[model samples]
Target: MTSPLHTTRRAFTWMLGTALVGGASACGLSGTGGRGVIFRMGLRTAKAPGEESPGEFTTDTGWRIRLSSGVMVLGPIYIFENASPLEPTASAPRVLQRLGQWLLPTAHAHDGHFFSGGTVLGEWDREVVFDLLEEAGEVRELGRSPGIAGLARSFSLLLQPPSRALGAEGAALGGRSMILEGTASRQETHVPFRMALDFPPPVELQRVDFVPIAAELDEGGRFVVEVQPHRWFDGAHFDRVTVPEGGGVVDLTPDTQVYRALTLNVRRYTAFAGTWEPA
Candidate 1:
């Protein structure tokens, strides 16, 4: 049987070709006349809508989670001039294009492979440690960078392990990319859990590529990244977590279903969103 990973990769490869052909008219190869602009960027964490408090939310499985602490290392943000080709807007043309790909003999040879061919509109290549429990409305400035003016359509970033240069913040994370301490309760079962994760598993899975966005970047602007940590546990099941014999905190590892679900969700593009505002 084909592994799920291989299946997903193969599907993505086909979608990639479809997107390239479908999005060509929208993302032309024409140059922007070398026009440049400087933009301010910021990042912040927010609770999913309807949550009563920061670091606190109830999962779909009836588990109520209250996190006492949360931290993450994220950076090297990139803005692309091309929108995600996989978007469902242009159905007829995409279907025709996909049919054409099906007839090509080289198509199967490119299965399970991927690449980005979009033009870079902006970037912030530095890593920053974020306190996921920070006030919801607070914005952490990421300095400024020069970029080409264009229609910003997609975003990408890397989730990095804490670096020593981050000083106390780095030390707090204990060399992990993310750390969360919290309590979860469902019905009569209550458990305290600590999850320290280098999410994406293989380390290189740190790169989150091509999240679709629609923003016009011109002259000068501000780019903002909002992270919703609560969504990271959307599919987690606290009831399945084994409680300690003496009532101690449970350390979540790869072996647990919660840990596995978190690893998959944290890398999901839905957990993060980016927008651009004109200055």
Candidate 2:
């Protein structure tokens, strides 16, 4: 059994019905005796593992960091049919289907990764936009698709500001992008800090590696997508973080090294996006 991760995903979702074989469309799921697949997407933080509740902590630089809100805009999730992702192929990532449109990547190499060798298993038309710092138990159900075919080896999606990666649900952020806010204390004095990361266009993760396994519809089975924010703050130094005179933190600005740490951490941790488990 794959041990369940504490957090889920900040991306797209689908509800495929059956398996995919030769000449089969990912949407052509027609399985029996299953309620399809339901993805429980949520966020996880850098709190000490096994700790029942997240707690304020002093960073390595002796600054106390307390999180208040953590939001992330992500989506347009894609699952690949690349069972043997280790081998390079001539197939690039593609949009298996759209409401009435079809899109495929014409470019061959992206950031040095070869997408031309993979098959798109399915896609969630709507992007999932949520606050990563919300109560984990309140995380939403991203999608409930039918049974999926092939043991997917890679998952991909985009990390963007609310401006891009529009959610088909029409429930995305009105104008704000991402909100990462908290309280930092130095010398027993508390300072408020908030970082709103809003990069226009969008940051795309072509491939997020995960365990390869063809999933089946088990009566009690569910697919979970976890986005661990703790990983995103990896190597971030709170002492280097700057705060305003009365309130707010300047480290939220994109130009700061503290901001760079957050981005680098997210990229490094994307590979552990998720895994399918059985009952």
Candidate 3:
């Protein structure tokens, strides 16, 4: 049997869901891998109606996101914002579904070890997906997994100005920012996109520090920018990142193995412009 502490860590890691993968690296730049550069990222939560509380026995729809190793650096960005009529099975009040969106920018890597060579984020369209085991005794199962523990260590919010990573100034003062843009879990091409942030880069391991900013959903179930934070994906990849000198182009061909495990359908896109501010 897994230790209670370990199980809890895993659960907490996935609670952030897809945000955990990309949370370690932002600005479309990979980390130094060897800890030479402290990868700091800050992220805000994109809240919606169903996210707060699942209304009386409804299908609580949410998202569970996982990424490939390479995608971790390039980021597909996971999001679970936006809820439906799905009902939660757990007695835990947190059993309600959550709604939000996320974004990811093309990232550059110098050494393959940085944020390169793996899935960055994975997303599930429903929060129930993570409700794997419902025994109340297993509630702590979420705090175990080293991966989850690693994700928690990657976020923070202790600074003079609350280090919300809601603005460039705060991020600059703190180090880096990782704003969530939106999430896509279904096969349809019409999903709404919400945004948030992750700061500092290479989050300190096993530390719990993340502040969530709520976003309002539009009449059409789409998200409208309510609390605009710092920058989404770091100013649309505005900052110049350094790749290895003469490093060959990164082969981003999607691996079927990683795809199936993460359960995400890949797509090529070209629209990143939007009506929001860089916090």
Candidate 3, poorest ten consecutive residues by summed lDDT: 67-76
Q: Candidate 1 overall Cα lDDT vs. reference?
A: 0.70
User: 107-183, model 3: which lDDT tens digit per residue?
Assistant: 22224322222322222211111111122112211111112111110111111112332344344323322222222
Shift in Å, residue 74, candidate 1: 0.7
As a TM-score, model 1 comes out at 0.75
List residue ranges in candidate 1 displaced over 4 A.
1-34, 85-114, 199-203
CA RMSD of all predictions: 8.2, 11.2, 22.6
Higher-scoring candidate on lDDT, 1 or 2:
1
TM-score, cand. 2: 0.60
TM-score of each: 0.75, 0.60, 0.17
Instruction: Output the number of the lDDT-best candidate.
Output: 1
TM-score ranking of the models: 1, 2, 3
lDDT of 2 by residue, 97-216 (tens): 221111232223333233432544444444556655565433355655433444456555555545344554223455544567787677866666667665343233322332233544
